[model samples]
Target: MAYVLQSDQRGIRTLTLDRPEQRNALSDALVTEVDAALEGAGADPDVRAVQLTHTGTTFCAGADLRNPPDPHALVALMRRIVALDKPVVARVTGHVRAGGLGLLASCDISAGGPGSTFALTEARIGVAPAVISLPLLPRLDRAAAARYFLTGEKFGPEEAARIGLLTLAGEDVDTALAPVLDGLRRGSPQGLAESKRLVTATVLAAFDRDGDDLVERSARLFASADAREGMTAFLERRDAAWVW
Candidate 1:
């Protein structure tokens, strides 16, 4: 079954994460499909905008620990979204966690509903949000990043927006996103490409410089005994040994 679904309408390409059964977790296959779709959208001249949305109550439940994605591939996918010539907007109406927030931060704009909750939950699983930090660190306020990254606390849409993790939060996120999508559709392709470049230059540089190191760091953590026990505990619906 396809994990990601693709469709185009009125010059906008929409990529929907379709793995609702898994809460649209970023499994290795799903990550590959999403990256490929973004690349295809960038190359297609008829596509002016891209919408990254998901179907389900949970936007994404972070990585699929059983079949985790390669750290290098995940970082490359985030960079692809950041560097894509056309504007990418995320329509978030559900919960997001860990690497899912990386996907949101990589987008040009993200709008979420009040139902949307977010958390940097990697620490709870005995790993740092290393690969995701490439996009998230730049978008999030320093203090907010430190707090959430360390605590693994869940926050709502209002706090997400306040912390710069979301561009906007509203009662109806899709309705709130319409105007922004309309504005993007009106922008000339060249103008959008150059403007995005201007805004993302720093992120691109960070990706180039630190991407490999972060990938290695993530792999090391995932392979650790702590992560194994934490993930096992989570799957078994029990507390990890360290949890008191």
Candidate 2:
């Protein structure tokens, strides 16, 4: 099967990640497909909104560091999504972390199942939040994000909604997404597109203005031994002594 699958229903385009055995981790190929899928949905007049989802237990486990992704590539795609002229909603069902959190935050809306928890583990991996921070900022006020970003702590569904990272935390994402989708469907498609445009333009312009510095800073953190150790420890099923 393909790394990513794109399907459209009633003008809603859903891009699903197909790499489950690997915890739906983002490989370069998957990232490429993500970019392409977003590009196609953004351009399709019939697609009034884009829904991002995945198959399997782990919604996404971040980057497949064995082959690791170029942070810039995924970051750039996020800028595109934030700037796109349509609403993007994330339908999450399971564990989501790191770059996966970036994808979720980039979406204008997110609905998660009861089991969902969101975390940013870059610092734990000896890396900075980078692009994930960019999307996370506008929604989660700076202070809360800073604490979560630095600690690599996992927060649950209600906390996610309280933090503004998730719009709905229901027993199942489908129930929450249903009403939100209907609301969007009721609006003028042109108006919805334009509203998205205005929001994206504002956010993307700001991102462009300060994005480089942040990315560079994150790169420096990524080179740290702690980040490498933490990631390695997690993969090896051991505790990470961040104090060391």
Candidate 3:
């Protein structure tokens, strides 16, 4: 089965994450598929915007521990979303964690249902959210980022919105997105592209300046003894060695 399902309507291209069994985790193949889908959407003249959503109660569980993609690939994916000329909007209905939040941050707009939950959980896995921080740190509230990054706490959609991780949260994601999508539809491609470029300049700059360093940091952390133990414990359904 395809890792991503794509459809276009009313100048909006919707890309649905299809790995419900894996909570749409960003495995190597999934990352590659998503990047290619985004590239196609950007090149399509009929596509004025891109909508990213997922299938299942968990929107994305960050990385697949068993098949994590290259840190550089993950960084590139996030950068592509920010740099894409058309607006990229996230319509989230479940939970998002770790690297998944990076995707949210890279989008031009993000709306989550009230049922959605979010977290930056890399610290718990004995690694920092290094590559993702390129997008996240620039977009998120500093205090909120520090708190969740250190504690690895899960927060609701309201809090995610309050901290700039989401544009809005509502009881129904599609209903909330109606006006936003309409606005995007009404915008001329050039107007929307220029507007997006203005807003995402800082984020793209972050990727340009710090991306390589962060990818190296991420790879090093994932290879460390602590991360190995943490990943193993998580896969085994147990606490890491330092967990009390």
Model 2: what TM-score?
A: 0.92
Tens-digit lDDT string for candidate 1 (129-226): 99899999999999999999999999999999999999999999978998998899899999999999999999999999999999999989999999
List TM-score per model, in order.
0.98, 0.92, 0.99
Alpha carbon deviation, residue 134, candidate 3 (Å)? 0.8
At residue 139, give the lDDT of candidate 1: 92
* lDDT of residue 239 for candidate 3: 88
Worst 10 residues of 1 by lDDT: 64-73
85 in model 1: Cα distance from truth in Å? 0.7
RMSD of each: 0.8, 1.8, 0.7
**Residue range 148-202, candidate 2, lDDT tens digits:** 9888899998888888889889997898889899888777778997888776776
lDDT of 3 at 209: 92
Instruction: Give the lowest summed-lDDT range of ten residues in model 3.
Output: 131-140
Per residue, candidate 3 scores C-alpha lDDT tens digits across 105-206 of: 888899999889998888887999888888888878999988999999999999998999999899999999999999999999999999888898888888
- Per-residue error at 109 for model 1, in Å? 0.1
